[model samples]
Target: NVDKAWDPIRIACHVYIALHAEKNEIVVEAETDDDCTTALGRIRVTLFHAEANERTCRARYIVEPPPASYMRKEVIGVEVESAEIAKDRLDRRVKLAGPWLTQKEKEDWEQKRKELMASNEKVFADHLGSAFINLCALNSSMRMRVQFGNIILKRYRTEMAKPGFAFDKFVNMMGQSRTGADFEKMVGGIELGFKLIHKIHQSPDMFCPLDNMTGKLSDIKPKQKLIYRKCGNVSFRLEADIDITVRGGEYQLGENSLYKEDSALKKRLDVEFLAFNSKFDWALEIMTQERLSSNSIAIQATAQDLLSSATVEQDVMDFPYPTLGPKRRLNGKDTANIHTIFQYKLMGTPYVVQILLARGICSDVVGYCGASMYSTNWDDHMGPNEGEICERWKLGSDLRVLFPLPPSTKQSSFATGGQVVDKHEGFRAFLAAVDKVQTFLSEAVSEK
Candidate 1:
């Protein structure tokens, strides 16, 4: 009963065609091979349509053929149901131009993002710059200021790269802080971190010794003793058992001798040195002090040598023996000789004094003349520690010291025909005299 009253279900109308290239439509006549056979016919495409309106459309050609010249393929296409559906589809496929964000949030986000990016970039740049400068200074002997600037840049870069921190964070941190102070602290921290990491990475043996389960010192013998010392601005451990003995004194046990065989003591020393050398400025100061001490010793030795080479002479007139009428002149060759020697000694003294002055030995000269007492002292006094010496020198009282000459040296021919000499030459001579005086004063102080 179901089959007798059955009717075909109507399918939705859609245009369908099989497309192919013309070159693939060429016919080929060949013999059959095994289970396969060949065909000699032109290829064409078949189109399918359920409505008369669809029939007027052009049909595509087929590029290849099988048993028949053409075959029809079924096509299923979707129709837009509503404007909202179409819009949703379009929106998913394409990006819309115009702000989809709210006003206040968008503005705030944009401003914050820009500020963050800028701050981060600046810090990063500074970190890298400082690193470069330090590298130059360490390797190529760059100026301290130049090296310091570079280190600042390097620190900025490093800080910028860290998470939850950007250039802006650094800027804010520095806003209430001094320019170089915060930067210096950051640099110091970074340097310490690097040193700690380097020790861990490069010299693991020192930190991680061979130990048993009891956490006691291992019986294993270390090949070399680690002697830790604070050098310049860095703390370094030397692999040597250096003997420390008091000069011109009896050798006493546990008095002046420092041994590194004791691991605990060595570790303590290492920590102390590291802490001392952590600050760049402090390290430099230590180095400078050592240098000045060494130079002072050398200057003293030179002065002694000069004195030994010179002779002295003295002359004296003696009164007549007790109740004698008048005083008589006596031949005092020894006194004359001593006086002559003293004169030579005085002359030779100036040379050593000059050297001392150059090395910055005399404190009185510094106090009296307000000049640098030593190289280290000069650097410390003029550099960041005391104040902005270079800035002040360039823009303040120091400027007068630099240029003591008048603006013009020439006078009109019509005016009084005075000597038309070089004022610049005279200024140069004046400076030279000042330098000579400084040198003399330095040497005299060193000798003392």
Candidate 2:
């Protein structure tokens, strides 16, 4: 929708091409050759010329009813997670805490049970601390990935009724796993597994579509173009990037605690008011009429005008994307980006979110902390089948802010910046604003 709406020219084209089994909607047994490059292993292909089915002179109805023999209709992306959580860890902790909480009903529970049950937070914290006791993670680190699939999108709540217990409820963390497919499901789609214990519903996944997104993106990319133009490479790229970081990372948290800097710590507590700034920078390229068009990998315009980089990157792939040199490279000379930095507290927090003006179709998480890159050629990708220019694009996807959402900013000049358990208006306002951005993006996707 975004692509066609932006520039119909970049939509799918027709050409002779072969797609792998995964894409062909065909099932095949294959072995992996770790030592080999390019792909896992080559499988035999039973080619059937389109002329054999229904002949056509040029590309006609190429983008629709995908070459029946090529693509399949099977769901492509993530699915809603249904695996039941393994309560063993949680149960064990419960047992240690006393199974009476469960054995006895609300009216029959014992005094200890009542006392312990009085504070699920205290119980969770106690068990969490115990769990960490055996954990060999000191200078160690823990990580979990969240991606768009059959996941749920939700807003944050001010008061968390529970301690985000179920200690090991997340599929990969403490949740149960299936037999064969466990390995490939590295990142758990947002499930009712482990979470902020508060906003357990919001999955930490990032999705980039040709246009705006409503939430889950499992059905967007492939369905958009049932049959793709094989010969003509339809590529996309992004140009802008914004980084989002929450306040309580190992470094800052450690720094604060180590120095006992109450004032410094209070200003950058876990709870925060969300704020970011987005800017766009763009330029134009003018060239010959011949250069304005080509039969090359067309880039689909994204959120056409809402964001310059989105559309510009798409323009680079197809017609009129002008080039100046003897090679007649992309003439569309300018690119733009969006810069967003959330203001945590009156100062800042570790929860950092980066909004980059990316242009193409790519998937990635937030860049690793302190990551750096050095590249040489950056234009080769712009050239045709074979180009002299060598360029590389590195992008990252959603890194959902996993920190517990505290209804609002926890600002203080001194004293312990404990959790905010009273009001939710601040957090609600934050989510509302964030949603407005989504609405704005959706508007961008819809406008062009």
Most TM-score-accurate candidate: 2
Clash counts for the predictions, in order: 42, 52
Task: Give per-residue lDDT, candidate 1, residue 126.
Answer: 38
Highest-scoring model, lDDT: 1
Score candidate 1 by lDDT.
0.22
Q: Candidate 2 on 160-279: residue-level lDDT in tens?
A: 113342211221221111201111111222111112111211322322222333433323211010011122122222322211221232101010001111221111101111111111
Per-prediction TM-score = 0.16, 0.18
Model 1's TM-score against the true structure:
0.16
